[model samples]
Target: MNLPHDDKTCGWYAALPPPQPARRLSGSQRADYAVIGAGFAGLAAARRLAEHEPDARIVLVDAQRVGEGASGRNSGFVIDLPHKFALENPDAQFKQRLLRLNRTAIAQLQSLVDEHGIACQWSHAGKYQGAVGERGLAYLAHFEKLMAALGEPFHAVEGRELAKVLGTTHYSRAVFTSGCYLMQPAALVRGLARSLPENVELLENSAIQRVERDGLGGYVLHGADGQIHTPRLLLGTSIFTREFGYLHNRLLPVMTFASWTAPLNAAQCKRYSGTFDWGLTPADHAGTTVRMTQDRRIIIRNTYKHVPKYGRSVDDSTRESIRAEHRKAFLARFPDLADVPFTHTWGGVYAISRNFTNFFGQLEDGVFASACDNGVGAAWGTISGTLLADRAVGATSSLLDDIHAVTGMPSLNPPEPFLGIGVRTRIRLAAWNSRAEV
Candidate 1:
């Protein structure tokens, strides 16, 4: 299917060689576990399940190849900090455990790279998110204070201190820490796909159509060409889980558009004093993240605004718009590099739950769902998969139960009729506000 170009220079994830397709099952099969979606969540879950039950049968199926979905299209930055703090939702006690789980998952990913010898470039350099204006600065200041009050230790920098690390005065205040790392994300996903043990079966290009009750207290997962019957079913579709009826209403799949610039020469690099390895995001209402790859190409991404009106797919217009915005953003932060041309651009869908937190637990008997990474999927997806595996294996883990018990969905304006139109209009106004600052 030749979808319109989401952006141009194949996304950062596409720089690596395409992964070998997975083997598809043709007939009805029975397994102890059936994981639907072979991204980090499914693959990690499958691996964890195998570790806990060496003799159990496990199968993983993806509509496309492994890492082909949002997992493969990410900016390649593995984050560790809680994207949303406990103070952000003061009433939610589980945020503490969730934050710790994110930290633990990132540590595990680093360990996986070492133990498996995955060749993806791994760097411990941290990520930076800052503010440029009064409103943005106020949010940063309060957030910094909240972090301190909550005992979340981090390097908070402002003015000259921030400029020393980033080589740009574009930010007024910033938060920095060694809590995250940048990786060749697609390569890591491919590496994991390659290393999945012999006992687990992976299916690529195998679209699951429906999961129905099996009548005998089990579930039957039907694909276009095959079926899998198991006592337990886990859906790891991430942002794409909207296609399934159960999650469609509660999950919002946003389009994140990204682009990569041509390789920067030493002179171009020196414009920022070669300190361009870090990832950046402005604390504005219309948040945009800036990152550079190992190849010295900068990557930029922002979320989808038009939902019901445009649906979830990306078109050439949206792709070009994001590219234009990125170039302008880069130049605003580093004016000397405004003339540089971007070499590649692309976009992908990411799932968001109504409540802003990714979810866990059984949506139905024997059918479990995990999605909505709140625009940060890498580390959280791994953590969720591992937690799910531990739960499936009957391991006594309070963390898993804690996450499932914390409920109350995030409410967004419905994407229907006038509501969808209003949502898009609000986004346009926000973008206008952002451009006005420029």
Candidate 2:
């Protein structure tokens, strides 16, 4: 349950300019407030706390450099729609409320980007949810029904339009929603870290070992290099919250893989003959997510693995297998561009729940925690982190209440071997069922 130290070999990280060397925690430190995990959630929480208490000494700590974890590893879609397979919530109003929350997060992010002039390739180009075969079409149809009930307008695109939007003729059915935006996640994280308020201390490359309360005072956050004593602490590490036994089996680690093709040359782009800068999510929950980067690179994310406790990254064999699957999926969607090969491939962890609900709230006195993005980490993490900060200071809002009711405590997972077996079996079955989409 240690915070991840492995590189995870994320293509997103390597594709960007080299990050500045991380400043590790040195000697001893004390803070008025401390947040563990510098991903979206933790960063948002720390930023919010600083806003509310500007003069307070605030510390934001991460296991790796900013944007190196799930925050930076995500597909970079700030989706207004809910996460995949997240409609299990019976309260219909919650869906609309969640959508509002998502938009709020997006607005806040945009404000930061504009105010700081962050160079994260932030785009409002929207996204396409495209379906190639009949199965994917069915899923799209279901989404249409849901969107219609919510009174949301979604433009259905197909034939030449789909081809032009997605850079391929594989999609016979597709819909474009204006709610989502795309970006280079690594850049966004680094930009966020750089833009943080001067009072908020940002600590990176500090793997937290454990948290223990001092006998007569505040909490002691023991890390690899040093210790931090703080009166207030927030846990935003998400999947690794299991280390503190706060979330326990309420969340499970689900790893997803993505491969980025080498940027297509001008001739290659012409031969592909589709849009060069666009992003698309799969119509099916288990289908592949594709993004045609502004740089003319095609990235495909398709496989999911329930990485074990001791490991967060996929092994070489799994990587090879997914590489083949990526190529197959890529070719199916873009047979004409078969020669364009992927330049980078990697996997990142997501915390899914047994019942598909994410969680948020206080764990103990002076300790607040938020996790379980369900599947959409970018927006969900941002909103949850902001909400957690409010909760920490006893502030109340309608959005915070909605998060509380919507994310109710996660369902208990089955015991170890059985839980792992059940999750793996379900993933395999679901992947096989969605083979056409994947």
Candidate 3:
């Protein structure tokens, strides 16, 4: 199924000055390594490959602009081993394995930000998963123990301590980790792309139309303007998995929408935000994640699968209803902001797999793949990219075992046959509840 493109975006990164226009492929060319999709995963692979083979000719191709996809559209939260994992009881044998890799991903990302000196407003203020009710608090309280038993570091903060960390009396309990960070998503992507070695080429507004093996070890990637032949190809395209046939079927493309409030002043900031953590994402599904930028714009995002549209073109009635619900949620969380106008509203498609885990491995000879971030792309994307690059360049990593454990099948690309019905039912129920609340 061809999903429509939804291109609406607003964030600090979107506000940055545009970089020099990238040259779309003009003629058939070859690179030592070719990366498709210039988002976090692709960029990570390209950057890692450059590190391993400094002189290797590397080329990155994106259909749109850099960071224009899920990477740029995300809330810019760098979280490791997110709650999605909690939903799935991954085998105990490799629980630590995933956590270690996640920690590594976060550290490596920060290292890159520092080494390249990319001024993307990166910070390591950590995060808080506050519980809104007894169930949420109970889950969070147990999560702390589970993470501890798994040898992962986590702290449970509650009461005044929770209030201190979250700067809100609304939170009765919370989990605080000093490891996560918030960033300007598009800025970081652009910054990283800019910091790449001059030898690496980036082609923007260039979409990969076809991929065929060259009969040799190399593969030919056909783009609109031109083509590329490379010995090694990394597939970093997520969400738009149909472009790669099999990869698409193994993934779930879910649409997540976010809205941004006009920048809040000092009084509003005191009333809305407290500490510099990335954002206050509820431990349970209250259907909202709240973030305040350095400039004090409040961003609230929610994931709901509807008629998939990559670009934010919705009917006037639907848009108005969404806006109203978003506002209502914001006010419930922060009553002081009830009257505040939201200056920007937009949404994007982020990919996830049926099992809710990122699938990464080689797809075909000389072609590797890594995607399905499941809404935690910042850290996982980095890890997947680095691992793929390492595998390509023949580097050793203990993560290979866990990587092999994630089996990919041809059936993953399309939504399950009954998924549309399930999704529609959930939407209707949510709408009914919202109306009943009135």
Candidate 4:
């Protein structure tokens, strides 16, 4: 089975102080429930399970450190609505229900942050979707219309106003929405792991190499140094779920690369006229995602590659090529800060489904899973895991119904070579079509 391996170059993780030493699982252990992958989904599932059954011992395990995976490697946008669902389906009811689910996830995360005093640089400063050229402007226009139809509030900005806010004239138009929150993703995930309930035991750097039936209607997870026996298993392993003998072709694991510049000096900061902390997503899907971080650093993320093999690492040449791409995008936005060098560059995996739906249901009689989040894993992953625990424990709520309504089964992907070829072709076409936006 494939296991997660970190490159240790993620800007968010590198920015934080060194984490405590990881505790690996050893010897034979038994728990009432075992949660795999200590990311947003796994952490939330383990915490919620503990809340439901305080006396039950729950084991939460990850292949790497808690904050060194995709959860920490993300761009850190806690989006409260669909990125572009309105354009394709235009189903107001579906969008509204999804909004409620996303908001609930955000609220739950906020409550935890406040209660635990997690200093993750949590910001309510909102987000901007910017357009650089005609294609991007068209997308921005559609987004505005959708927001208007849904009665969602948004403010449109362009020309001088847009330049003033973004500190860049590369974008010709933009839209601001109040519901999104930005934060240090690595810090947030680490905080969540630290704040897990007392009954939950976290085991890090303990990759589960194999899983099998323990005969008596339970499962046995074989890790490097030890094994876990449990009556129930919940997998939040994202794309790695296929290694556990589930999901199969239902998930497309794509790797996206990002780079963050060294914190700007005082003079460079003066040249950057934007707000202290703000995030801007491209209006076009393939455009670059840029953020001005709280610590005065600039981040640029773009480029995608399909990786059927979950643990394959990017080659040195490809990494260098991606870094050049990031540098080009950074220069396009901030030519004045030409001396600002990128301090970190890294890639992370996020699973996408063929039909853009997530997998969140029973894998078998005793195994439950929540995989594909389609790139909005922060809020979506959190809520799905929370509700999955509720479902596993036979608890019911309207929120659970909403998750079911929005997320059906992920459509099956074509087998092997065809799947890889098709995904790469689609990505190339998108990048070509949005070349100006990049």
Clashes of each: 9, 0, 12, 0
Off by over 4 Å in 1: 1-10, 85-87, 91-93, 159-161, 308-312, 405-415, 433-438
Give per-residue CA lDDT, model 4, range 209-284, as digits (tens).
Answer: 9999999999999997999999999999988898888988788889999999999999988888776799999989
| Candidate 2 lDDT tens digits, 1-438 | 555744466777887788778788977999999999998899899999999999999999987889878888888788988665655355678887888889999999999999999988899988899887899999999888877777788989989877776777888888889989899998898898899998899999888888998875579999877999998999888888888868786888888888989889877878887776688888887899999888888999988988865243556887889888899999988888888988777778878888787778988889888888877888888899999999998899999878887777888998989998999999999899988888
> Which pairs of residues have clashing backbones in candidate 4?
none
Model 1 C-alpha lDDT per residue in residues 329-379, reported as the tens digit of each score: 677776777656787776676666545655676677777767777777788
Ranking of all candidate structures by their TM-score, best first: 4, 2, 1, 3
Tens-digit lDDT track of model 3 for 1-438:
343365544555466787787788879899999998888888889888988888889998888788667788888788766454543465676555666677888788788789989887788767777676666766667777776766666777777766654545666777776767888888988888888776678898888888888888788988767899999988888766556675655566666677778777767666654554357676655346777677667777764655544454355466556667778767766676666788766666777665666667877778888877767787778788878888787777677665555434434433555776765676667645433121
So what's the TM-score on candidate 2? 0.97
All predictions: root-mean-square deviation over Cα? 3.1, 1.4, 3.2, 1.1
What is the Cα-based lDDT of residue 19 in candidate 3?
71
lDDT of every model, 2 decimals: 0.72, 0.85, 0.72, 0.90
Q: What would the TM-scores of all predictions be?
A: 0.89, 0.97, 0.88, 0.98
- Model 4 spans > 4 angstroms off: 311-313
Query: Which regions of candidate 3 fall more than 4 Å away from where they truly are?
Result: 1-4, 86-90, 159-167, 270-273, 276-278, 306-309, 312-319, 405-417, 426-438
Global Cα lDDT for candidate 1: 0.72
Decoy 3 TM-score against native: 0.88
